[model samples]
Target: MSDNYAASFSINQPGRDAGILPVNQPGRDTSTSEQSHTEPSANGGSTVSTRENVRPGVSYLAGRLEFEPSIASKLDALITEFRDGKSTKGNTVFEAYDFVNSFPGGTPETRKFALSEFLSTIDSVEILADAARRCGDRAQIGLNHADTTATPRIEYTANAPNDNALIQAASQIGSKRARSEALSDADVGPGRENDMDYRSGEKRAKLTTADLPWHSEALAARQDGRVSCQATQDLLYRYERDPGWVRRQVIISGVAPPTIPPGEWDAIFRGTPVNLDAVFSSVHHVLPPKEDVGRVGSTEIRFSNPEPSKRIQTANDWTTAWDDVSEATAIAFPHRARELKEYGSYIRSEFSAKMPSSHRKIILYDIAIRNFVQGGQRHLLTDFHLFSRFHSAIVAPDGVVSGSGSGTKPGSSSRGRAGGRKIDGSKSEVCHRFNDVGRTCPFSTASCRYIHSCKGCGSTGHGQRDCVQSGRDSRSTS
Candidate 1:
């Protein structure tokens, strides 16, 4: 309430409080009476008056208004009337400005809040003016405020324009004048030559965009779209960024500090605030999100704005994810890299051949990726059927798969079951594992369903490991 408008607001003072920012107070002059930033006397000392620290009131918004300046000067008179218990008589600027100033202004945060609310009011006023013009109401429209502020501050009461006795008296005077002159419908001679309605004549053609002001360069640039958006991103690389000392301090404190809930604010005011200076530094190595499905009942995952860093990039491409992965893979592993290539091909064929975008199937593909093309879970040679000739390839030659991280152990007998007594193929069919014994493979003990029997003449007693048949009895393993 003093002429100093709170001496704690040491705005524009350099040494002790130079680092304190102006918050959202744009275009404001804040040279303190304590120090002169601009002019100096011959004695090398300040000549700044007490007026330097004096509050500008509505004059603070003079050149700094974000909207029309028409009603700006009227604000001083109106708000003065409001503060001194005089009537504003339903002027909007007074009520709104008083409401804004009614907020506590000791802290930069509260001042910033007041500025933001003021700007919002100005914007609403602009929008209202536009609507008023559109509705053929030429009177300059002001803010029709929501009553969160002014009504509580004063004994505010609504009085309609029709309720004023002066307005009724004015209307009566106008009616008497109309009767005296009988104008707007005066008697004239019947023979009138001039056409009163210019619209009744040959109509003018409606104008196209060609008739209006158009910037061709801007239009061309929009169509071309090679220009970068140049939108500034908050990467939290804040310190050591600003050239000015004040801005750097603002970064350390905060610029537009996050709006807190009422309870949180109360707690903050009561308790000590944690001044921890963001210990963790940001790194470039980022992982894909752990869970892509952000919400329940929605299979499609939507991209959200990345926090901590406001970096945003957008693109539309025709190629699928499979194509991109495949392209990267070939560069990492060449064509001769049989294992990786086989795995890639298998995954593509199973899930993304026609590129069916089923998320569940992609999950299955991820499971299969853990196992390679040479991952050994092959069928035992004892259980070999029509598929034996197909298995005789590079990855695993024998039925015992090397490095088989699976249910079957390597080099365990398919026939070496039932407490180690080898049962020949007297009761059961021939073991396919025995079929490959002498020629191509040595028998490895892996679990098999078929019995160890001879391929020739189905004899289990004579040929257990080797088939002695030479003439007219050698049959194929297939």
Candidate 2:
């Protein structure tokens, strides 16, 4: 069985009290000047003392309880034994040492608990010295061996209390103390030479390194272009095997296309051009005829050509010309055109939802502007403008008109209503004053311009069902 040992203890200065003293009066000596300065002499006589001669010991243990709870519980038993007069010694270091050593393995955790309990009765330094003496006695056989390597690993075995789990808990407690005052491995217990297997049967605890934050930061530095990807990967693998490397590789692959020999480009682009013209012609033949002037409402109404020319006359015009041809062909074709339009609209709506609103608006605006410039139609631009104006009116401060008029300034009457609404019974007053003026009072009318109002009461004064005065009147009548 593996040996179990908990961390040891170190003395530190206790926390200071934060309470403030009462204010001193003008004649009061707040300073230590008027106080008696005397010290108790070794011979039990008074001696002259100064502030410089005074030194204070730690008032509280500035450390954590190092033992597991189970081992610490045993201290209560010892305390009971002491109270019952069954304990052999009284208020001595040897008594604590003997009590702790009685455990099957005087593991560090058990020792620490014993020290804490002993200090509750005696002093910390004395308890620590006693523990060291006890450890020295147990390890005495191997102490004088000239072969420094020949040391038996003490195996802690007992079921009454287990300290194994906490013994391997990382060194944060010991590291918090100053290096000089820190507990050494020797203070805990001698490490096992033959007891190599340290695996615990309890749930396996994850081992986290102290420098994890630094490692993550280093990887981020590489991602942000401070270092090469290969360098980052190497650094990461040095600490732990991470699956994130695969994701990083995929991202790098996407951003940078793999290099291909110049000879491959010609072969790739040599394929025959798609017969877009034939496709458009076939679509035009199968489509319904354009609407007649009488059918749509005016004799002067002329439908523009449903199919644009497909051939690209200039390099700059190719993309625009191709797009127009494709669009016109789709509009002319009946079944396929309707299906394509619906599918395209669905895709655009989904993409718009996923994209930021600002980005979506910019894209929509660009498409509308392009359609207008191409002499396609004016109604699309008109719709775009209306939508943009409505969106701005809802979001922009100046776009929001406060009054019935379209002017940007907040109306004087609106401000008056807002101020008057705070007064009791002002709802009836405002309604009588404004009802005939074609401006409904925000207080009493259902057609009130103010958005925040109680729908049930038809008044801005208070909610109908929760009215306190109404409830009181009902109770009185009952």
User: For model 2, how does the per-residue alpha-carbon lDDT over 260-366 read when each residue is reduced to its tens digit?
Assistant: 11111111122112233333333334343332322344223333323433322222222332343335323222223443344345434533553232222323333
- Candidate 1, 1-478: lDDT as tens digits: 2222222222232223343232333333545322112223344432211112323432323322321222333444443343222453244444654544564433333333233334433333333333332233322211212212222211111121223332333234323322222111121211111213211212243232234456455345445542111100111112112213322243355431322211222212222221111101012225422322354562334343223221111011111322333332222223323433554455444344322222222323233333221111121112224333333321232423211222223465434333344343211233565654454325322223344445554554433335555343343333
Worst 10 residues of 1 by lDDT: 228-237
Per-candidate clash tally: 4, 1
Question: Distance from true position, residue 105, model 2, in Å?
Answer: 99
Alpha carbon lDDT of each predicted model: 0.30, 0.32
Q: Residue 7 CA error for candidate 2 (Å)?
A: 99
Report how far residue 65 has shifted in candidate 1, in Å. Answer: 13
Candidate with maximal lDDT? 2
**lDDT value, candidate 1, whole model:** 0.30
Q: What TM-score does structure 2 among the candidates reach?
A: 0.15
TM-score of each: 0.16, 0.15
